[model samples]
Target: MNFFQFFVWGSWLISLGGYMGNQLGFSGLQIGSVYSTMGIASVFMPGLLGIVADRWVNAERVFALAHFIAAGALIAAAGMTDFASFYTYMLVHSLFYMPTLALSNSVCYNVLTRRNFDVVKTFPPIRVWGTVGFIVAMWAVDLLGWTKSANQLYLAAGAGLFLGCYAFTVPPSPPYLDETRKKSLMSSLGLDAFVLFRKKNIALFFVFSLLLGAALQITNAFGGPFLDDFKTKYPDSFGVKHPNLLLSISQISETLFILLIPFFLTRFGIRNVILFSIVAWVLRFALFGLGNPDDRLYLLILSMIIYGMAFDFFNISGSLYVEKMAEPTIRSSAQGLFMIMTNGFGAIIGSYGSGWVVDHFTDSGGVRDWPNIWFTFAGYALALAVLFLLVFRDRRIEDIKR
Candidate 1:
């Protein structure tokens, strides 16, 4: 369940921008707009479908249905030649696909809890396999020479279809259908988590999460195309020849960095750990701005390494922070709110905003000033870091316990 779940996404997520920009003649805005579909779907679909899984059907079934529909959408997207058709299909794909991310976890949690397993101790190992699946899918797509082709979408579709069927084989996760319990749509959707905004510090933390999330989206949307573009300057470069493989280093780095998060959180506290992430984001973009396929290839590799820190620190640490701060009853809802801010609103901002920045640096003949574009991103991240430092306050985990 974990492996094939991410396999479907990894097949296309990193490479789709390159495919759109290079092969389909999509402009930066178009590329960003396409990437934003994930954000658009994430804003509401997870909660909406979660309600379905909670009230009407088993989570595994909803997970399966979502994958089946997403697979069809990916196949449809693969056949589209125009932006409108492509975006429409991809949006359909996103609407179904994004929900499965949460549904997969729900299914896992339900099964694990029923089996009397410690989710906190056991789930990470299971989750790591998903990362392995992602890395494998990335390498498979790149090695198959499908990085800039529609074949990546087909590959994703194939994985999705397989996972959709495989979902039914899992233990059943039925809805909590008690006669005494009634939930309004808003409550079921976790909208009550919005009340957390009354606390200024928590509110500021969420705001910074949104800002840093934009940096993340920028990297995901453009990192591959940026490396692939090096073909013009250094056609023999390893990065140009296999951009997806080189970018996979970031995921490898992610697995390693995740091991250090416990120490970072214990040693520095949540606020400082997240601060490190914002600073890492600064370095991540600045290095990309300065590095190339030639002598500075190490910089690119370093950027990829730093990505682990940039990504894991903010997401994992912020989630821990949310867990610490929220009341037990609202904890799950608070987590959902955190995702809405980061993956939903933040994704929309980053995708569309970075598209404009990319277009700004591109000339009429379609030559993009890659260095300047990266530098601009770095500047944005730097500003976010500085602002986050000034505005957000932290309570140490020990203090929170008291």
Candidate 2:
């Protein structure tokens, strides 16, 4: 169920741009709403809902209720024709929606800890299936011809509803907090992670995390649409007919690549793995800029292939690095801080920036100026790579391994 949440996102996340830009004639900023909505909601909803789960409610119940609420909002969104109304609706829905990412993780942690599972040994393997779920959902959406159509929400709505109900079936996870403790709402909700921002190195990492995050969403918000644009540039292209599934190849790559991480992190260390991700991002964008939806598609396909390294290398290794760096007492809080930077602020910056850039550079017809857009994004990533290499001080995984 947790895995499929990402699948719901992957189904339309990349393809929505094509629908908005090519099919519906919407503006780029309008297209950006998809990314921005997730970011905005991550800012508050996860914390508030998490607090409720911590003190008053069963975690599974909270999960089910959130999905149920999101399902109704998504179904209502399915009927929206205007962008503003649709945007507002999705935003509201996202408030209920984005927190589930953490809630699901929390639920899993509770279960695993209760069962005395070794999370370091067992969890990563299980979590890899979530990537599988994401890929499957993407393939399904693409194969079904549902990209950008209102019908895509039906897919997500069904998933949300099922997950909501199925959550109740999971072993109950009641709030663990003591009711008599004099806890402030911030502490209750786990917002105490904010204190990490006062430190210099951590703050720098988070700042760059937002910048890298900008690059991350660029492909997500644009890949399907960019590929689909090939149809217009050269008519009768495969992308026009098949954008969703082809973009799904990235998700497939994500699954295959995550398996390699343990070995890579052990051998190359966090800095090198992150370097691979940065370099991969540059390649990922540049390949799309050069490749076509037509015969030169090998390049396009290769770009999709590299997405695994570009996304997972940085994201997963970064997560592991946080685990290695933090004191045991504050380890969970450190993870929360990492998420706030990457998912919350980073996602917001990336979404709005990508939207503004795409919106401003493209003409009224929604045709993207591909090379310039991609190259500019690559440049931003290059800058982060350089800054991180210089400033963050490298520490080998072997040195950190317990």
Candidate 3:
């Protein structure tokens, strides 16, 4: 279930920018607008669907239905030629697809907890397979020469249909609402999870999450396009010929880092783990700024390698922290809140902000100043890292374990 859930995403998430820019000739803001659909959807869908799963419907059923609908949207998106039509289809697709992220985690946690498994220890291994599935999908797209083509959307649609069918076979996870108990309006509407903001620690964590989340989409929205830009600059370069494959190194590194989460979280605790993630983000962007495809190929590979740490340390570790802190009844809602901060608002900022930077650096000749744009992004990440270290209080691992 987790495998194909992410496989569908991987089919296009990393390469879509290149596809739109190189093939369809989308402008920076237009591409960012398209990617921002994920942000807009994340802001509402996860919390809304979580409410249904918690109070009304089975989570597995909701997950399946979302994917089934998303499959049709992907098929529609594949046929779109104009930006407006493509954006509309992608927006619909994202609305249905984003919630499934939290839903999948909720389903896995429920199943694992029901079986008396330790989530901190068990969930990382299971989630690693999702990264593996993502890597496989990336390779498939690149190897088949579909990286800049609509065929990638078709591939995603196929995966979505498969997962939609497979979700029904997963362990049943029904609503956990206690019908006899009187519920407040907030609880009934699933907004009760917002109460966590009243706690100083949780509030600070979420604020930092929003900051970090802004960094998340910068790479995904532009990395492939950045690499593909080399095609024109160095037409004979390996990076240009296989930009998708080159970018797959990031996912490959992600798989390794996902496995290390149990060790990192247990040893360093969430505060330090997240701090390390911020530092890694600094390196990730700086490397991109400094490196090129042919002569500085090692730097590009290094950037890809660091992406694993930057992404896994903050995202997966933060999810685990939320799992530890949230009550069982509202666990899904808490996850939705986390997604809202990171992927929702944060992604929106990163998408629009980075798009503006790209446009700002482009000359009248249509060529972009890639190095300066990357440096600007790196500077943004560095500022966040410094602010996070100064403002957030660190919690010890032993204390959290209790």
Candidate 4:
């Protein structure tokens, strides 16, 4: 299940930019529409599903159903020959897929608690292996030459099919059928988590979450194609020839740095670690703005290296902070709320906003005005960093009363 959750993402994710731009003959905005489709699902499904899992159904069953739907959606997506059709199927697919990211966690938590496992101590080490699984899936596509082809969709579909069936066999997450059960499914879903927006710190965190998310796909949606373009502009370019392999470096770095997240959050605390993330994000975009496949290889490599710190620092550490801070009754709900902010709303902002900016700058030749676009992104990160420092006070937990 851990493998498929990321494996499905890997298929379309890393290579979609090149496929959309070069093969489907799309402009950047059109490609953005496809990417934006994910935001639509992330918003609705996660909370709704979490509520269902908490109240009426088993989290594992919900996870299986979601994967089944996602598999069918992905397979349908495979048959799409045009952007609009592809986007529609992807939209449906993500509605199911996004929730599973959270549901899988729910299932893991339920099983761990039932078995008396020390989740805080044991889960992180086991979870680190999921990053390994993600890296392996990424390399599978690269080595199999699935990087440039539509077959990547099928690779994901196959995994989804397998997991969908396997989900039922896993340990059951019987619905909250206990004496503690409260209001019907509606309230259990923590639809009330939305009230959290009224809180100053949460509201601030979510605002920055969206702005930072804008940077998330700026690279994923453009990086591979950008490197591959050098292949054409410089036919002798070795970088383009091996772009997938080079891009894989980011995942390798991603896997390694994620292991350091628990430590970073514990030692430096949330504010400084998050500040590090913002600084790293600025450099990430700046490096890509200047990097090339040829002699500037080190810059590209450095960009991928920082991707570890930039992405894992903000996302992983942010989630841990929520886990540490929220009241236990609504603790998991708080994490769900975070996803709605980052993956759901933030994704929508990133996908559409970045596309518009990219479209605004590009010429008739389809060449990206990369430096301007990237610097513009850097400014966004910097602005968010400033806002975070000014407004969100992270008082030492013990000093603040409930």
Order the candidates by TM-score, highest first — what do you get?
A: 3, 4, 1, 2
Worst 10 residues of 3 by lDDT: 176-185
Tell me each candidate's TM-score. Answer: 0.91, 0.89, 0.98, 0.92
The CA lDDT of each predicted structure is: 0.82, 0.73, 0.90, 0.75
lDDT of 4 by residue, 70-105 (tens): 889888987887887988898999899888877776
After superposing candidate 4 on the true structure, give the runs of residues whose Cα lies further than 4 Å from its correct spot: 117-120, 178-181, 184-190, 195-199, 327-332, 395-402
Which one wins on TM-score? 3
Global CA lDDT computed for model 3: 0.90
Cα TM-score of candidate 1: 0.91
Please give the TM-score that candidate 2 achieves against the real structure. 0.89
lDDT of 4 at 118: 56
Query: Candidate 3: where is the Cα deviation over 4 Å?
Result: 180-182, 398-402
TM-score of 4: 0.92
Model 1 misplaced stretches (Cα beyond 4 Å): 112-120, 178-190, 198-201, 319-335, 398-402
Angstrom error at residue 200, model 4: 3.7
